[model samples]
Target: MHSRSRDLVEHAVTKVPAVTLGFWIIKIACTTLGETGGDWVTMSLNLGYLIGSLIFLAAFLVLVSAQIRARKFQSTLYWATIVATTTLGTTLADFCDRSLGVGYPGGVAIVFALLVASLAIWYRVEGTVSVESVVSARVEWFYWVTILFSQTLGTALGDWVAGEDRGGLGLGYETSAAIFGAGLVIIGLLWLWPRVSRTALFWSAFVLTRPLGATLGDFFDKPIAQGGLEFSRFYASGILVAFIAGCLLLIPQRAARRAARD
Candidate 1:
């Protein structure tokens, strides 16, 4: 009876997709697309970061609300929400780091604090910050907020470490991408070690993927003179969107199970 009840609860409540390679592939692509798409609106269209942030922020609000109201895990809705968070993150980060003149380091610090605070509060209230613990509306709210913070932090951190100074560390995008990619590899390896907490590894990888995507996005869209390919932002974003769509069609995903809550 207990097992049956547990199964029912798990099936009914877990709205997040199970962690899988396909999920990460799409996630990285979405993050890259976010950077390029956000740039397209803000730079290519001359809308500026403030205006871009407002537009993407509105989309995030609408999509996340729908995601929370959903009764079952819908892959399309979930991925859509993820993309919204990424785009919003990009614009919001740029607004803070450049427009506000806080610099990327300061922007990263602020967002990192917020991200940690969100996770801490969620852990305090829910007793777990695991994705599987995203079992209620409140938890879902916390989950999204944390995700948004992490995404924002990634953008700022990427710029701080790699972006050519609008205010950056001057590491260069290619080197920055390599560094972040290596970090992901280490996190992935640690995830296999039972002694290491998967939650920490998961969050680490999640944060790292953003910088990787950010650098990759810049590499694709920035001018060749600056060590980038100089592809048009819109063109790059369209390609990323098609790639994400293809992956969604080919890959399989389902709600996370209770057995391995990582």
Candidate 2:
């Protein structure tokens, strides 16, 4: 009884935001920013994927460290770290697919494997992979690592589904976005079933959001000839940043709750 009470208390100290509509809204916006912002650095500024990856990786490291050290959640810092991961994932995925000649299919395979491995290791070490269980530093480490792989995998999947006939099915960006959108809707329906596992649904939704944002981002920045609006990557990124900041101000974030009892 004592141990159970103590566990409940610790769970209340979660550092991540509660999974809510506002959370998903901000997350999608951030992922879109990741795509456009990453492209701006890697393509528009001609920095190349390797350089862009390194820059975002550095920022992720610094921000994650600060995040782990924080006694409680800081909305701005937390969201910034998420953006760092998305940007790093963007360039890193590109580096693997284009620079290393892995191709879109290979990049997706490699990153998916890493994501599964990260989750497996986390479940093994922590005995549970619940976000509400992330009150400890060790769990936080696993959480971030899993997110990194998932984000990278998302970029690869998006590119694979939307790329030209050379590597993908040649589906346009709009089609790819619609596909991922449907996936999210399916997951939402599953959530309504009492027999379904919430943890599984949560992760599925999380991963799908990335690809949805990726395709949307591509649609915003690619040339009109290629089915995009041809908007400036810099301009799109700025708009996304403003949208996220505004949402943060409008909706207060709260730490996630413990997963429902098994």
Candidate 3:
């Protein structure tokens, strides 16, 4: 029975989305929520970045632990954990940048290093750094670690690019988002060019989307002169969370269906 259960688990593992358009959409939404929601707690609610990071980090630990224990890939749980990680990443990045006085560039540099290191370690441990191998707990840990680092890095990079001449780039938030969006378009063309490595293209787009969403979130939450909609971060976050949950529920994705299609 144990052997049979293990086989079932492995079968289910091979049946996830392979980073399609819908996948990117939901991922961007989650990242945007991460940005605004984290800011709502840390800045609007006046919780302080350190305390906010601790709180979100605790939530991430709990959700990821549950994800590890599940017998099958429960979509809701998996995506919920993703959302949790993004939120935690936002707070952690803010803690490093604002609270610790590292500034955006410094935070981006440190987190970029961490993201690269996480990928190196993942490749070393897993032999292949494919998202398809996320069945095992070890690879899953590596995946989430990489994700956390990327999300945090995205926040820092977005801030760095969007601010005034204070940062190196000096692009406004909307302009930064446009530039990143254009980059993603180039990546999409490369991915479809039939010459580029699919694996490389996939990871590149995944990382780029995080920062794209980060800049969009900033545009939604920042002041008018700064080129933002000036929406309440709390309201924006709530709307994004609802949208994500609704999409997950209505997406008609099933492991069995995905397995058959693959």
Residue 206 Cα positional deviation in candidate 2, in Å, after optimal superposition: 1.0
Query: Model 3 off-target regions past 4 Å?
Result: 1-16, 165-168, 255-262
Largest TM-score belongs to which candidate? 2
What is the Cα-based lDDT of residue 132 in candidate 1? 76
Using alpha carbons, what is the TM-score of model 3?
A: 0.89
Tell me which residue pairs clash in candidate 2.
none
lDDT of 3 by residue, 197-231 (tens): 66567667777887788888888899887789999
Clashes of 1: 0
Whole-model lDDT, model 1: 0.89
Residue 212 in candidate 1 has what lDDT? Answer: 91
Output candidate 3 Cα RMSD. 3.6
Instruction: Identify the runs in model 1 with alpha carbons over 4 angstroms from their true place.
Output: 1-3, 10-13, 259-262
lDDT of 3 at 44: 95
Q: After superposition, how far is residue 46 of candidate 3 from its true place, in Å?
A: 0.5
- TM-score for each candidate, following the candidate numbering: 0.95, 0.96, 0.89
Candidate 2 C-alpha lDDT tens digits along 1-262:
9999977776575889998889989999988999999999999999999999999999999999999999998899999999999999999999999999989998999999999999899988878887878887898889998888888888888999999843777798999999999999999899889899787888888888998999999999999999999999999999999999999999989878665433
Cα lDDT tens digits, model 1, 2-58, are: 999877876564778999999899999999998999999999999999999999989
